[model samples]
Target: MVQRHGDEQSHVMEREPLLSGTAQPDSDYHACHSISEEDTGNGVLKPVPEEDEEQSIGRGETESVKDNAHVNVLKIISVMLLGIFVAQCDGSILMATHAIIASEFNALKDSSWLIISFSLAGAATQTLYGKLSDIYGRKRMVIIAYTMFMVGCAIVGVGQTMWQVVLGRIVSGAGASGMSALVSVLITDLLPLREVAQWRAYVNLVATLGRSIGGPLGGWLADVIGWRWSFLGQVPPITLAIILCSAYLPSHTSTVDEQDAAATDLLKKSKFSRIDFKGAFLFAALVLAVLLPIELGGVSIPWSHPLIFTLLGASAILFALFVAVEKRQAEPILPLDIFHSKDAILSFFILGFQTAAQLGMMFSVPLYFQVTSNPRPSATVAGAHLVPAVVGNAIGGIISGSVIKRSGRYKSLVIWAVTCSSIGYLLLMLRWHGNTNWFESLYIFPGGFGMGVASSALFISLQMVIDPAHMAPAVSFMYLMQTVWMTIGLPAANAIMQTVLRRKLGVRLLELGYDSAEVAKIISDAVSDVDFIDGATEKVRNAVVKSYIDGLWWSHAFSFSCSIIALVLAVFLKQRRLDGHKSKP
Candidate 1:
């Protein structure tokens, strides 16, 4: 019995009806026949959200209900922007100020763990959180996640040493991971199909804004006061988010879409049903075993060392178990169906590599600066650099958001974004060679802008492809891959750069003119050389800079490749109008 909804009457099939708890059978979005609230459309049981009115041809005798839907979408966009900014800002700030952290902990020798632990924890839990978000409500899950992040930030702020900071970051990472998934899910929950990009643009811009602003802010705060304050800075945005969320985010249950609203829909009301927790465990274990070694390996011993191999072997076992269990389990954390979408799997792979390369650049650039300096910026001074990345990110966010708001589709923006990123990396490569100027960094802003566009486009893309039932899992899965890539890529970049520097710069040092045998003497003497001569040691300084520049070229190369791959992926995606009714243009 579908009770008619609202005061107005419209077309018979297109008539608005609230959920009245009737078991009226329909053949719609799902494979199984069941009664579900459906969109105004053909008699097929579509996914959870059946809001597509275009397909529902007869729905609007007058479009007042349709008008009301638009107003609600705008409200949802505003709420999502708040969450995106809070979470993005947190991730952006960490990279901006890692240099400051290393000095404080006195652990420059073994610093990857500081980065890895937080990343690993975040990656490990994201899938679980994604599933839980679907099981629980996205709004409630997000709020709880943010609170946990804030708690972690607070803990990091008060910590005395590396472990404390690492602990805080891990907690923060877990919370942040939860948001990464839910933010996308929320976009689907809130927007009409056509307006997904329009809605995402706002959140994407806010995220870019937070990152662009936060880098410098984190650096400035750490430079002026202390490194601990970088973590401390996170509290403001998170606290602001909590307050805004409480005020603006309306209550929403994690409603199951018609497609896989519950296992019963797909599997005839299974008497025995629970997600294969064991498989999820194995997956997390697999991620941990492989990732932990990759991140911590080169630091402890060579990459080919027995210890690293041992862990990798164990990881192989865990992954095998995860795959076997998932394939057999009635309900898998990873829906095998999703992988069947070649485009989705390929996109996930590309996106993961892109994340790794991006984060690796963020992780390495500061270290290049610090290692060369006899003494790096007092913790506070160096941290200030984070401000520029933050500002650029914010501006990029705004540009992408504003543009998408006007345009229904993000295809051109995706192409442009990737192109710009490619240019940024190429320019960054040049800057590393000898052109360390702010104008070179203009490339970075565009790169970030491209990232902003890509993030919006990618999030919407995943949403468009999957059944509404799988939306949360798909999002979380994307997140997990990204985290894994970042963990692997950052340290791997570090190892490669270090190895390259030893070969390129170490042997070449002072051989150009300054005495090779007397290099240290020359450096020491140069402190007083200004008194003895024309202060020609500027050449030495340039040489040192050149070394960093050369190493950073690898980052630029990787970024360029990632952007190229993204462009290639674009070719496979059929264009669609954001009008959201389905079937691509």
Candidate 2:
């Protein structure tokens, strides 16, 4: 039960009794209450009068209202899941088709931008979506996100140039960021912390299904119809999701303190002024400056280029300015105060490192199979290999959710999650050499499983450690770190692969008595075209494959390092009680 006091700005959440009519101890609840008492000097819990409570519980009208509210919550969750499915499915489709689409326009070297542009745009706007939804209402934001995603899909379907497709991806990514962040926020709003893990497992299951189907489905569609059709096919589902959200989602704003409400009413004429546009702009600029340099440097341009230095310098300045601007705003896009907690800071970095490792592997593994497998599998065959990992991800989430729900503990799960991912990456680094067996490919399953478990444990732990008022911003912040790192990790892994492959392949060709010009040409063609190995001489093909294996070894090493770091950080996360009842202190 939650009670709102007009004078107190904080929320007091009570623990529900167990089924056996026994109350469980809740240390965090008592800690919060103690803090409230120390601050206000009169944090007293009020009990309802027995007669009044009986009358309220006895009313049939109240029971009917309760039933209606429960039904409405179910309706909201059902529609929201559809939207989550669309966003996740579309992302996986792009992952499968990105190389094929980029090659069509002979922009294979620039294919990383296909994903980077989307992530860049998403990371820039991710945190702002939370604050905007708080002011404008979640339903409106959902409709807007759905419309933008649909329009972006339409643009990509009809795009005539690679740049146009990239532009569409930017738009779609912005909408997808919101759809993903808001769903988690909404789930938190509707459920207690203990239950959040269980529901999140369902969300992960849906996401895994989308990813599992999307890879093969996208590849098949690209092979049968055109790659353009892959983008076009997503439009109808997103449109339906948009309509459902507009019709079924409630249009309620967040509850504010009475004094704050009064202040809002007074500023009704200038409500738009309250938005921290300066902070938002600075943050967007900072993200772009930071990511663009990372994505383009040492690939499109030399790392030592003047433009790279300029962008890095600008990013530093922008970061300082963004922090300053946010500190002054009453309703900042990101609540800087959330970082005050040790747990909040640790959770952000843990999420970043884990996501970077997981997504980096996802970006690389499909290409690894296509490049290294015997008989040279088609795109569809290559994509289908990820099914084991997806299934593992779903199973891991379910198990972690069940364990957390029953045991009311997550710290151990988090440690195990990172450990499993580290071992998975270690196997990849050690075992995935040229012409790997089909069974050996199952090495990625543990990594996927670990990520799935981390998703639930980390999110629930973050919620337990922060103030309830910071929930929305904190959730968005977590996603922002995730997207930012993903954007960096994918390209970094690719860059490592490219760097290693070029040097290794070029040297091998040179030692084989090939001319410098021929070696350069062969290396260029091999990296840019996956089909090059199929058409090359046997000796050249072997060399190219060996170089790719060496590069992948380094990439997997990077992921393993990240996972190990996350595991170390997980050890320091302070455990909190899941149940809401006061402890027996």
Candidate 3:
């Protein structure tokens, strides 16, 4: 027989022996086929059964359970996700609770800062957690994240001043950065490829649900109890999550035993046989330095402030050094090799665009209702409206998973996901002009369906391209990007709308030939008041209200365009659906 005997993973099989003494080219294949036939009397070749297949499957299942460091990883994920929900909810949650928190603190004039502080801090630190988890371990880093959150929660609960609460909110957001990508990392590490997408989709469903509902729940809780309890309420859920995760989470694959074992095995190689502190340090500094500017830009400080410039310049220098160190390090944290992979880079931008668009919707749609006279529902209704989206997310993910398993291809499903979602985004963002019942119903469900399908497709495609060893780091990379972009995306969209609205209103007033300063004063006065009595403000009032509506309409158009970019990227993907032990190379 000519088949390779030592390796079981080879895709090719060889035959033997009929040509051993003869000159026949196919004789060796015949000989091997005969031997196989003799071993398997019916001419079938398969692993010999020492036990029934079901019993064998059960025994192997137990061994797998023992091998996994944590038995209740899923439960921990559930708890961790709950924590993620609350923190993420806090970012936009302020939209609903803005008046309440501001009333309690006596800072009604500056309530917007509550939302901004949390969002900025959360965006800046997400990527930092990815590298930290890679260095220490997911389990340890998660604990750190919760501790930070708990600290923030305590600060907010005991606050006597608005700044103290801002500090608390900032701390809570930093902690959220850790939870952002860690869940998906653990999912892939703990499960088989066949199961990764469906399970990841479930986790994503939790994230989306928490994101949508967390705010309203915070609002209702504050109303029923007090605003301070909103921060205090988070502690119990986080405390429980820590206990469950510590008891269940295994040491990362970078553990000494796994590393040693990898050295002996060919298929499993350690990506971190030796640490590269230089690259890691530079990487963290680089991430922090660059993000500080983007996060604080136009909000707390001028964009050209010395502090911002110093931070951004330092970030640039560190990025250069980090790349240099990664090139030389035997075991690198950045894993430069991954950047060269087609799907890896594409997935990054694809995810970046996707998240940016999502963040804009989450922020803008809620604001639309909160500020408007009559809309679909109140801003508080975001929680209930999103329930359908959650169902859609889970369903789309499951359907995508099934399609891959049954058909062994991904491009078609990916294409459909992109197309449907692009149209859905358009419908949701469109100017329906008038309030028709059919118009409302038409957009919401279709948008949810498209979003759900695309969410699943993203997981499948990402997991397919990633190196098995850096699975956690890879997931972290993506999650960090999404959160960062999401934070920036919202502010950028809002900033654009605000600027455009001001310019348009100013132009209309200018055409009437009113003194520029007088026109500015009139518009400013209208915006300051909460009341909207038509005759009181009259012509000036309509201009302000019309400006807001027009700005929102154009903002929707911008978000829809971003979705189109993602749809285009989906077209270039080469499908790979992993089943059994063989994933596409």
* Candidate 3 weakest lDDT stretch, 10 residues: 15-24
In candidate 3, stretches whose alpha carbon ends up further than 4 angstroms from where it belongs are 1-95, 98-137, 250-281, 301-314, 370-395, 401-408, 428-430, 434-438, 441-445, 511-513, 525-536, 581-585
Q: What is the lDDT of every predicted structure here? A: 0.60, 0.76, 0.60
Ranked by TM-score, the better of candidates 1 and 2 is 2
Per-candidate count of clashing residue pairs (backbone under 3 Å): 33, 1, 2
Clashing pairs in 3: 1-16, 16-28
Q: Which residue segments of model 1 deviate by more than 4 Å? A: 1-71, 74-84, 92-112, 157-165, 213-273, 360-412, 430-432, 435-438, 510-542, 576-579, 583-585
For model 3, residues 1-585, the per-residue Cα lDDT tens digits are 222223432222221111111011111111111111222112122222222445656867545533442334354457567666666665545667767877777897667677667765665566556555655556777888888887888888888898888888889878876776677665654444555666666666666666666667777877898877777877888888778667655433211223224323521334244455677567667766766676677666777789988997787888888888888964566667657667777777766776666656555554454345443354455334445544665677777766665665666776786576567667765643334243363454444565566656676676676554444556666776676676667767776767777777787777767788988876665445424324434566556666766676666666677678877887777776454332422
Candidate structures ordered by lDDT, highest first:
2, 3, 1
Question: How much does candidate 1 score in TM-score?
Answer: 0.74
Question: How many steric clashes does model 3 contain?
Answer: 2
lDDT of 2 by residue, 1-585 (tens): 233344542553442111001111111222222111111112121223222544776667545544554454456668878778878888888888899999999998889888888888888888887777655655667778878888888999999999999999999988888888887876665554566677788888887777667766788899999989888998999888988777666544222234444433533534466567998899889989998888788778999999999999999999999889888977777778788888788888887898889877887798899988878888767867777777878888898988987888888999999999999999999889866787888999999899889888998888877655456778988999987888778887888888899999999999889999999899989998889999999999989999998998889988999999999999998877876521221
